[model samples]
Target: MWQHLSSLRARLSLLLVAAGMVGGLILAGVTHWPLPQLLAWLHGGMGQDAAAPTPVTATATTAASVPMSPQDLYVVLAVGLVLLVLAAIWLAGRALDPVSRLLRALEGAVASYRDGDFSFSIAANRRDELGKLIRMHNELGHTLREQRQHLAQRELLLDTVVQNTPVALVLTDASGRVAYANIASRHLFNEGRSLAGLDFAELLAEAPQVLRQAVESGEDALLTVDMDGSDETFHLSQRAFRLQGRPHRLHSFRRMTRELSRQEVATWKRVIRVISHELNNSLAPISSLAHSGAELARRGDVDRLPGVFATIGERARHLHGFIAGYASFAKLPAPRPVAVEWAGFLEGLSLHCRYRLASAAPERAGWFDAAQIEQVLINLIKNAHEAGGPDDEVTLSIHDGGNETRVEVSDRGPGMSETVLAQALLPFYSTKRAGTGLGLALAREIIEAHGGRVLLANREGGGLRVTLLLPTAKAPPRG
Candidate 1:
């Protein structure tokens, strides 16, 4: 019952009832004792005065005016008090009605917000604290609604992009079930059928062997597959991340055939231009020299003939060497693998290039084309020496991975810019005035011929680091 009376309305009703009871008791007491005694005293004093003789009619009138007994008056007062309390309670209920309604509205609005329906608001029509609270609630609702609208629009835009993008995107849950697949992925894997809830492995069951192998490897790879009798290349990228405290994976496949074709055309154009320019450079000087030599012969200037022949021969040799470089690049042969001790290989390389050993050479033997690898290292070390760093700071390190050998040459010099690093291995790309641009390109070709790769990156603090990753066993070289 006390808990029931805890509310404002119940407490107010109780206070009103208590005030009425106190007032009724005080009225009953005064009317029953002090009021009647005072009247009797006044009447007695009037009768005792000799000059002011009371009329018999006046006394009768006064007796008549005393209407009821004290008992009857008490009853009437109690009934009045009861009626007043009932009226007060009714008034209190009316006064608190608006507040009760406001409380209910607030509850519903909160529930709506919790349910992600931010469109609910309370009406405010007063200039009091309660009204102020209602206005604030409305403002909060408005803010939430605006935020929700903006969020929905953003989500729609993102979904549209993801759905329409050309790259095939697939998202898988921890159990390897396909949770989401975009339009491209659906078309590529299942003839435009939805891929949700399907096994990811089953999707690859009918895929080309190259793609399956690449995906199974769980690493970024570029693969070529024969589709409809034509070869197409794709680059696959995979990433794993946690979503809502659960693991998920994203796989992306981007077709690179068209892009690679464009790049190939551009590379051949560059090669042609370089060859033509070199040919013009060497032929122009030789043509003038030949004309001068013929003039001397016609004049019988025998003494200058030998000097002219020497210059002509030198020019011929330069032209021959330039053509030979291109021919060697075009006709690079497969690498002949051989087991070579790292110590002996490093000793042999040290004879041709100067470098500081950054770490001890791996004791394990390396399996690759020894002569080709030596040439690649020689070219890289030469580049480092000429890279304008301190000669002593040029460093070489070797790591013996279980299945691969890594050889790194680092130099403390100005590192390559992003653009230079990107195309550094492309044929005929050079920065030097007299560079043939064949050294790094030839090195890349040789290493790739040995079924290896060349990686270039800017080292921390300064300079460039070139890494050659070669297989540790005798793997047949790629043609």
Candidate 2:
């Protein structure tokens, strides 16, 4: 209690009491005089007669009879001091009210900053020191909010670039742990798996040496990597810099496989078109001459004309077959679908193309242009036979794929290499010297036209497998 007596509240109370005493003294001094005497003094200053002393004498005699004691004066002073003390307390609370409100606002702003929120700000309207302090804090909050917004925009732009770009990007920390990976990185390097916190070395396990050298050196390096059993080349770019005061690496991988494949296919198509045009121009005259010579020989010249006609006829037939192969591939017709039973279709396929059936046909039927699909199957079966030995039997199987029917033709031939299979369906890409490379291409075009797909790959048992996927004839189940 004694310690608190010297506190601000206590000191303020004492000062209030002291002020009351000083005010009491001033009031006492002014009021203790006879009222009549004071009134007469005022009248005397107004030029009234000396007879005004009569009222002063009466008032003086009355005050003399009721003179106040020291104790009475002390009582009045004490009462005035108590009123002043109460007034001081009321005034003190009013003054401290604003302080409490300002303190709360300050505390809230500080907490918001700690929580990474800079949107809240204090509004100070008063022209005082505390108001000035609030305005300064509000300025700081505004600056922080602007900075937060700027940073968010930058982060959004970076994520968009990283995820949407065709190039694969991998970001790592100083210790080579993966910190960030873009969508392409997940696809090409991680097989669509999470890359965060994974070791950089493990993420690039497919081409560890290539990636390591690229990361260590601050330069772009072009390298070829084996992906999906094919050698795919990529242009790699690397840069090392500090992020948030820590060293980091950004590695970019751009694939060149599609671009190179496009260029190669474009060149081949141009060459094939040129050769086909020139051959057609020369074939018409040769066919006409051969037919004229054959007619002449059949008419009468039977000595050397018989052998000449036979040679010309043989050459013309070969030429016709060669030209027909190119023309049929180049001028494929759209599918005109007709419902065909699987059993009859397989019988026709076997009789025409000599493909031995390996698996029994499923009960389901197929809907496709019989002629176009037959051509697809015949080409596949013929290629299978030609690719294999004379005794090797090409096997045919049918798989009911619910939505699509899969017809697989397997041959026990020397299987194509990884590189060859990748380009097998490309036009003018063939293993055989005499092949126009149009068989697989035409098959693909026909299958795709029917809203189906064609896939060619090596079979598991050392042979080539050609799969033709066509839409099934069966209706879909109602949802």
Candidate 3:
């Protein structure tokens, strides 16, 4: 009778009948002796106050004399208890049906949620507290589902950005071991090998100073490190941050060598074209002039001879100067770095240039060959002046760019077209009628020799901005 108590209905029925039987026994025992029986027993036990007793026969109540023994009483009580238990079980099953359904729904919903499926919803059949709770649980599932989807999409977008960016991206754990690497980082720092599972220190072995402070003390720093003897120079931006519940450092490397090389090649091609065109022009005229003077002298018509010689001399000098410029460009020597103050440098530039110069120089000095760097600066300034209108201002600004010195020369001239800007540094590709097209090209060569680069871009409103980046003494010197 007590075995199947798992159901709420069974347990309630069992408890109810057991309580009724216990109460009935207590009440029966208390009133078992009536007033007369109790008084008689007391009289016999106390042995007191008996007046002359009348001879009266004791009589029992009609109900007490009925044909009933202790067995009959037991049987009747058992029958009643069984009936009560059955009735109680039936009522409890009906009353607790809603609770049973809710429990089943909870079980199923939890199972679905565990499997990452949030579509399961518990039904709210009754307008009661349980119904409201069920509705809230369903809403929770929907909200969680939406949030999960949004988070996944965001993670995908972040991964795409990290993978596709040209700057090398490296993620390392608190122990400074590589945890993740983007494609650019793998190609740049890992010798095209996968960067995962490798130690960051191993990759930076030759250049441990690249992120020494950051690795040891979780500091932020900018570093220039060369990897695998590639001509490229990478500026490493490193810092510590939290990722995946643990501390990690992110290293982003931006390569600048390839860009500079492309600029240099374009400059050389332009130079060749300009040299060819100018040489052909000067040589053709000189050849014709020489022939004309010879034929005229043979015919005894020598009155124009002085003019012819003068013309020939002028053409020869022009050609000589053009060729000499080409030779100088071709024979550019390696830079001999020296320390120079910005004020003195700007003063010397002022004497050479007629355009008004604006200036901002860094407090710390630069490590560069003064003459070669001055050549580059002079070329850029001249280009800026020519690109701007007569009234336009030529501005020179310099800033300490962490690991390098950034110098910008901006002018207010009409900006170059895409086609012109793309090939502006090529030798023969010049907009001016008499331009050799070697100015920017030669400047690039010199700056590159000093382990720097030239960047030419159009100004926001109009005109051109030429930028030069030179490594400072603090930065590891480049080739």
Worst 10 residues of 1 by lDDT: 60-69
RMSD in Å for model 3? 11.1
Candidate 1 lDDT over residue span 45-156, tens digit each:
7656745775666655543255565665565567656766776676567667878899899889988888889989886676556667889888988998899899999999
Across residues 266-305, which tens digit of lDDT does each residue of candidate 3 receive? 8667666777789899989999999999999999998989
For all predicted structures, in order, the TM-scores are 0.69, 0.43, 0.53
- By TM-score, rank the candidates, best first: 1, 3, 2
Candidate 1 vs 2: which has more lDDT: 1
Residue pairs in candidate 1 whose N, alpha carbon or C atoms collide under 3 angstroms? none
331: Cα error in model 2, Å: 2.4
Which residue runs does candidate 2 get wrong by more than 4 Å? 1-270, 273-306, 389-392, 473-479
User: Predictions ranked by lDDT, top down?
Assistant: 1, 2, 3
lDDT of 2: 0.76
Local distance difference test, per candidate?
A: 0.85, 0.76, 0.74
Candidate 3: which pairs clash?
A: 270-426, 270-427, 270-428, 271-426, 271-427, 274-428, 388-413
Residue-level lDDT tens digits of model 2 in 1-479: 76567344566577667666766654554446443344435545554454454555555544324444565456546655665566667656755776789999989989999999999888767555566778898999999999999999999998898798899899999999989998998887777898899898765566557666765677897778766678888898888899999999998889988998898789677657746754665576567767777787778656766666666566667667767877877677767777788899888876787767878888866788888888888888888888864434688888888888888988888989999889888776677855667789888888888878888888776788899888875333111
